[model samples]
Target: MKEANITDRQKKENAIEKIGEFHRFGSILGLERMNELMKRLGNPEKELKCIHVAGTNGKGSVCRFIYSALLANGYSVGIYTSPYLTVFNERIELDGEYISDSDLAAYTDEVLEKVSQMTEEGFASPTEFEVITAIAFLYFARKGCDYAVMEVGLGGRGDSTNIIEKPLACVITSISYDHTDRLGNTLAEIAREKAGIIKPGAPVIMNVDTDEAKREIA
Candidate 1:
């Protein structure tokens, strides 16, 4: 048991080290690399039903509420959110249970292998968020989650999470002035970026109070 525990610790440490490698490149906003990574992984994101939530604020709250409602109804739900409050495992959960350390380490190893292969083929390496998003999709799909509530990590358009082709619902909550440098300088511009999460034929739920933002999202 002592040996097993030590091995587990090593795996976790290795996984964290690999994750740190991604931060060196910083956040390059674009879906092309994300799309390529997903495609290489057989597009696990398409295998599950998902709710895509985007906005400058309250996205995590909206995802939590939706996940809670689904779980309360006896459905298996997965949640993928960013900026974890404590640990990286908090960013991915199944039925309110954070992924186990063993699983996280195993998935990180698997993802890193694929990413390395992609690099060999001349594809740009995915960012940290993109890798985590891919792992969440794979986990949710493998776990057979009935619903997955995915929170946008950044602006909707170029964010890594936007690789999801279509979602059960597209939710934009309380869009405001934020990410102005990357999203835009004005409410309309920000709204346009947030609206990018709205997929075709998917119902959109909006809670933005700004008329200009609402119009742009509409």
Candidate 2:
């Protein structure tokens, strides 16, 4: 299958190789493989309450808000975001702290063992986003986080984070002009897509975006 571009950083002959392999087979937006992978990991997401945030922009900000609020409320919060502001490991946090270099290294090994087996068994390796997502899940689970805030890596409808069957709530940051090639145009259309997060009457918060966007939310 055709693949997305691989980052130059993956050229390294180390743990990131698994990350690269993941990108190779990670195409076609769906929850089957992700659900399977999460199950193999024993559904760490089940024991955790999560705030899943998604939108074109301001997603990270929304997650930051939820994470901080959860922390201030005396809850241990773990956060995971996409396209880190700078460093890759910055994407994963444990109780308001970034995952340590040593922990990232160790976790990469654990991630690789599972990811490799998945690939060998004819499962897609997962995308860069998916692999990191898995690592984030494992970290949060192992670290005993009370809640984890996850920002969708792409459209909410088929995002890897959707593998989490339950969440404290779903938050759509702002629906605007971005990723149109995948999400479609018109606020209503995009809203329909973002609305995928609504889990059968689950509580949702959409405090950003246009009136049309809000209409879509309604």
Candidate 3:
């Protein structure tokens, strides 16, 4: 039993290290690579019923609220958030539990195989967040989640999480002036980018306090 635990821990650590290697690719904000990668992975994101949340602030909190609400109502919910507060597993949660180390390692290896194929086929490598987003989609789909609360990792339009075709609902919370370099400087420019997650026919819920944000999102 002790040896098995050690082996599992080692495997998880190795998987995390392999994922970290993609950080060298930096944060390229586009969906072409994500779209191609998902195509190769059998398009798991399409299988999920997602509630997409995007904003300059409060999106993570909103995700948690929705996740908790769904879980409390007896739903199998998965919440995918970025920049985990502590461990990598925290970024992918289901039913109030972080993804197990064994499962994380297994899914990471599975996605890494697809990523390797992409590079071998002469496609650009996925960024770290893109790889993580792929893992979340795969995990949620395979786990038979009833719904997924997906928090945008960055600006919604080009962010890796925007790859989802349509969500059950699109929520934008409190857009602010942040990530000015990547998401643009003005509130309206930022709101437009954040509004990228809004798909036609999907209901939108927002809490924009500024006229600029309201005008752009409306």
Candidate 4:
């Protein structure tokens, strides 16, 4: 038992270190690298039904509500959120349980192979958030989740999570003056970025208080 526990700890530590390497790339908000990476991985994000949530605030709460509701209704739900308060595994969950360390390491290894291929092929390396998003998609798809609630890491328009072609629903929560440098200085600008997640046919649910933001999204 002691030997097995040590092995598991080593795997988790190695996986976390490898993933942390991409942090040097910072938050590059674009889908080009993510699209290529997903294609190389067989496009796992397309296999699962997704609910894409975006906004400056309340994204985590909204995602939790949706995930819990889905689970209560006997659905196998995958929850993907950002900026985990504690462990890295907290960012990915299925049916309220965090992803296992073994699964995280296995999926991280798979994604690392594809990322290396991308680099060898002259494609840019994916950012840290992008890599994590890819791992979550693979986990949710392989686990055969009925629904996946995805929280946007940054602005919705070009966020790695935006690689999802079509989601079951697009949700824009309370938008505020946040990420002004990256998103925009005004509410309308931020709203436009968040609105990018709204696909042509996907139903949208929003909770913006500002008319300027609402008009842009509407």
- Residue-level lDDT of model 1, residues 1-218, one tens digit each, is 89988887778778878888899778888998898888888889999998999988899999999999999999999999988888778989998799877888988888788899999999998998888898899888888889999999998989998888889999998888897889899999999998999999999999999899989988
Over 1-218, each residue of candidate 4 has an lDDT whose tens digit, in order, gives 88987887789889999999999999998899999999999999989999999988899999999999999999999999988998989999998899988899999999999999999989999999999999999999999999999999998999999988889999999889989999999999999999999998999999999999999998
Model 1: clashing residue pairs? none
lDDT of 2 by residue, 101-191 (tens): 5677677878767777887999865777777788889889988888899898888888888877777789887788777777777777787
**Model 2 ranges off by over 4 Å:** 1-13, 25-27, 208-212
Please say which candidate is ahead in TM-score: 1 or 2: 1
Q: Of models 2 and 3, which has the larger lDDT? A: 3
Where model 3 places Cα greater than 4 Å from the true spot, the runs are: none
Report the CA-based lDDT of candidate 1 relative to the real structure.
0.89
After superposition on all CA atoms, what RMSD does each candidate show versus the true structure?
A: 1.1, 6.7, 0.8, 0.8
Winner on TM-score between 2 and 3 is 3
Residue 74 lDDT in candidate 2: 94
The models' CA-based lDDT, in order, is: 0.89, 0.77, 0.94, 0.94
lDDT tens digits, residues 76-179, model 3? 99999988888889999999999988999999999999999999999999999999999999999999999999999989999999988989999999889999
lDDT of model 3, residue 61: 92
